[model samples]
Target: MLADELQHKIDFKTKPLGALGHLEYLAHQIGMVQNTVSPELSNPHMVVFAADHGIAASGVSAYPQEVTYQMVMNFLGGGAAINVFCRQHNIAIKIVDAGVNFDFPAGLELMDKKVRKSSRNILEEPAMTSEEYRQALENGKSVVSEIAKTGCNIMGFGEMGIGNTSASSLMMSRLFDLPIVSCIGRGTGLNDTQLLHKIRILSEAIEKYPHIETADEIAETFGGLEIVQMMGAMKEAYDQNMLIMVDGFIASIAVAAVWKKDPQILNNCIFCHVSDENAHQTLLELLGQKALLNLNLRLGEGTGCALAYPLIQSAVNFLNEMSSFEDAHVSNKE
Candidate 1:
């Protein structure tokens, strides 16, 4: 339950009654997350998880599997969109090799949490063995734990893996009990024929898992290395009471996996945006949540988090610095 006292503090702000609309709600939610009337934002970090999906070999994406590692190099060189947005906002960004196929030379600034070179193609078999899934979960937890130790209480998650949107679409269909067609989308610029092929492929892949009832099984059956690890990081962040900035569709699916296991995790999450991905709006509707923005954004490297960060700061700023009616000696509304 939210504290009644916090609600009172928000209502008593100097602005006209409810003038701030969702912003007031944003302030209250952040206040509740921190359990303080004067909540502060500190040490914001955006973590981008990179990996390769074996399903990528099934001709599901516009790009090659090598782009997974190539984009990781782009991230390290500070040339990707994520790097640009993070640098603009001064949010620290880190790349984790959750299960990318390539291995960088020693001394590269990256976290080596690879569980394997890539996942097993789900259409053919399980994406990963249970032990591998467990390791991915633990790796995610450790990464977030270390970040939290550095006084970072606000965090955002992103992912980069060719064909991962297929992985996400499959998980959404199964975990949320929706039709695979409703969950399908044009990931990475698929043409009409390619999109139809993707739907048929994923639909057949879903038939392979007839008995996945638990969260772990669902994850191992229909998740990428980056996504599974993201699920773990999300749970750990929620457990530690860290605010979660959820990116687009793939990131939302990761959060959904965690939420299915423990619904309370949604309390700390701020849905950053409704992605341009077709299934994203449906996913948000299923969660009964409103995203902060919708700029037709389909880029998925936590760009929504970066774009939304300033608004989050604004929420805190108004709560902490705005003039109260009494403080400004303004007449009360009649």
Candidate 2:
């Protein structure tokens, strides 16, 4: 369908012009994405990439690194907020062990795609070798390819890793050329002194990489396995023409990395929320995009994906199911 035709359909939806606000835009976008005025959502999925970061030992985050594994178990056991929201929205979530520091028995349901126990400290060396980075990207592509085989077309990216916020902050600083202090934020509820310590640690870490400019250099220099993998997954999802849902802060950094690789990849992305993290709003504005919701959400385990799913559904429903003025036999504007 032509873009003008899609806009006409949205404008005649038995309501005032633009009465639905963002929903009208969402309906038009989805119609364009699917190349159908009556687009239907199917097999909505969320993937949470879990890893451990070396910077967790440097006192950047309030939570211990062990919480990464603990939360993986929480996701497996269906006891986390992502679980609740996905259950409510009928979206399936998959937890991938991108590079957590722990090992699980073979009987567990997790996808054992670990690249390493943990990435190397960014303050000392590159997070992962070039080969490892390539492998992580391929592993991510493999995961999404399998999901696509199952006919899942809509996907969201989430992440879990202690000290990942530090990685994200450093990435933002490098990507936007913004000051490190502007991108830093409290992770896992850091108190005043702990937040100050995080700032100091990240500032020192930034000094180690002075010449990193390209996307690959910035990503390899300071990315968690989960973040890099999420970037790959996002690229693959866009390649398949699937709808991409982006979660909060850490997850957004992964999306940013994908944007660096190919700016057009964003055409398929629906940013799920504006994270409560301080830098998240700034990053969103820099990208010239608006999220579907706010809710002051900072939890990263794809919670925004699940919460935003209903609104996406509403957009599809109105476009396909709601009658236009002619269909409803209502009078049109003279």
Q: List the residue pairs that clash in candidate 1.
A: none
lDDT of 2 by residue, 1-334 (tens): 4689989999998999989999998888887778887788889999999999988888899898999999999999999999899999899889999999998878888988999998888878888899889989989998899899989889999999998999999999999999999999987889999999999989999888899898888888899999999988989998899999999998888888879879988788899899999999999998888999999988899999899999999999998888999999999787
Which parts of model 2 are misplaced by more than 4 Å?
none
Q: For model 1, how big is the CA root-mean-square deviation?
A: 1.0
Please provide, for model 1 over 237-334, each residue's C-alpha lDDT reduced to its tens digit, 9 standing for 90 to 100: 99899999999999999999999989999889999999989999999989888999999898899999999999999999898988788888988788
Cα lDDT for residue 160, candidate 2: 90
Give the backbone clash total of model 2.
0
Q: After superposition, how far is residue 70 of candidate 1 from its true place, in Å?
A: 0.4
Span of ten consecutive residues with least summed lDDT in model 1: 1-10
- Model 2 clashing residue pairs (backbone): none
After aligning candidate 2 to the native by TM-score, how far in Å is the CA of 186 from where it should be?
0.6
